[model samples]
Target: MSLRTLAVVGTGLIGTSVALAARRQGVTVYLSDRDESAARTAEDLGAGRAAPPPEPVDLAVVAVPPSLVAPVLAESQARRLALSYTDVASVKSRTEREILATAPDPTRYVGSHPMAGREWSGPRAARAELFRERTWVLTPTRLTSKRAFDRTLDLIALCGAVPRVMGARAHDEAVALTSHAPHLVASLMAARLRDGSAEAAHLAGQGLRDVTRIARGDSRLWSDILESNAAAVAEILTRLQEDLTGVLAALHDLASPGPAVPGGTGPGGGGVVPVPGRHALVDLLDRGIAGVGGLDGAGGGRRGAPGRPEAPAFPVAGGR
Candidate 1:
């Protein structure tokens, strides 16, 4: 099924970006948010009109927080707000569970997460091309109707994001590793700067800036996200803690004086030898390099995919 009209709930960064992208593709869009001013801002930016559609829309895109997804979807479905519904929340398993329990028509809903965003938030930060070449995951259960799922695929195509399908639980666990846990790690590292002296602050370089860039995200939003996916994030943090302990042990060895060399003969005779666990530090650094290189090619930059089509044109209404 093709998407002609879309109703976007929550006119924040992701929501407004979806509306703007859809509108740019000639799909009529309606915008709404708890913050009326935000909706107005998105509307002013050519995303969509800040009003509910006169009739049921082809699809309703819920772009609210993970915890609010089920309630918002239930309300939208009850009002017949759209012929089909989908959400752009980060955690899918929890949202899907709530939808099955609370929504009037769970079959009409599919859970999705668009793996794209900027450090900034709100409509002002929204961009029509924010999702181009990005991975947008769709987590559809057996209960999801074919018609609803197809409509969501069309919406993802319009947004120029490559669609990847995964089970709800898998999606949650994947994001916990790639995003949720890393966010907390960044925040923890950035927090250390809070007590730095003037000289230390002045000596800060790009490495510190790069590592903590994501720490600038809205704290309340991140807190909610972390709480929703607590189990998965906790598991990743546990593994990270193990690695950190090893690294700390290696650092302690490096800081302590090593045993003197047996052959006491040259100038300053027995200079302290290299630390015994130096290999551990080198191995850790090597693993970090490999991990970063792996992420660089993670997408493989494939073409002709759902959201990465070559020669993409404006989607024709009622046409695939």
Candidate 2:
């Protein structure tokens, strides 16, 4: 069935964007947020009306942070805000577990995470097109009703997002590797620039900018996300730490030369300093290239304007 009425439980970027996209699809949207000003901002921007739905809507998208998803969903369900419910929190496992324990009707709920966002947050940064061609993950449990799951797919369709279903734990682990850990790595690299010398800052180029771009995300929100997915993120970071240690050892070996290449090019062409662990450095670079190349067409799907629904290419089923 097509989604007709919708309630957005938060007016942040993801929530506002969902409201805007739904509105574009002719779905009535009611927007609400803890920050009244933010909800009004979304209303002023034509995302939706700034109020709770007078009666139950077709679907309610709970777009709160990871820690707040469970409580928000429970509260919304208590009010009977929508016939079905889904969330846009980045981490899914924790939220899913809590929802199962707290929600009045866990069968009416499906845990979801839209793989689309911007560094800038809130309604001001929201765009109707933010989810175009993006993957929206649905982590439905065995208890999830088919109606609830289908409404979420309708919501994703209305927002022009492709739906990919996975288990709650799998979704959390995947995002930890692809999104959460990468954001932390970027922030770590970006932080180094804070204490960098003026000369070093001046020499910074696109490579540094690209690596640090996501570091501009709201820290409070990111802290909540990282805390929710701590175990998965930690697992990835631990592997990264091991790699960093290996690289550091190789760098030290290269710096402490064991041999010298007799050449004619230093001052007036002297002997060249030998790089002892050049092979390790080259191997790392090659692996980096391969890893990046693997991303090309990793999630293939067709792009369309926001609100233009597309039929999913495959049958939708949640992972174990």
For candidate 2, lDDT tens digit of each residue in 1-320? 48999999999999999999999989999999999999999999999899878889999999999999999988898889999999999998988889888899999999888889999999999999888888999999878999999999999998888899999998999889889999999999998888999999899998999899999999999999999999999999998898888889899987785556555554775454446576677778887777765554455234443564544344312212
Model 2 Cα displacement at 277 (Å)?
2.3
Off by over 4 Å in 1: 257-274, 300-320
- Native-structure RMSD, model 1: 7.4
Q: Candidate 1's residue-wise lDDT over 1-320, tens digit each?
A: 37999999999999999999999899999999999999999999999999999999999999998899999999999999999999998898888888898899999998888898888888999999889888899999779998889999999998888999999999888889889998999999999998899999999999999899999998877888899999999999998898889989998986788655454467665454455667777788887776665554355133444754453343322232
Which lDDT values do the candidates have, in the order given? 0.88, 0.88
> What's the residue-level lDDT of 265 in candidate 2?
54
Model 2 residue 229 CA deviation in Å:
1.0
TM-score of each: 0.87, 0.89
Clashes of 1: 1
Worst 10 residues of 2 by lDDT: 311-320
Instruction: Give lDDT: candidate 1, residue 39.
Output: 95
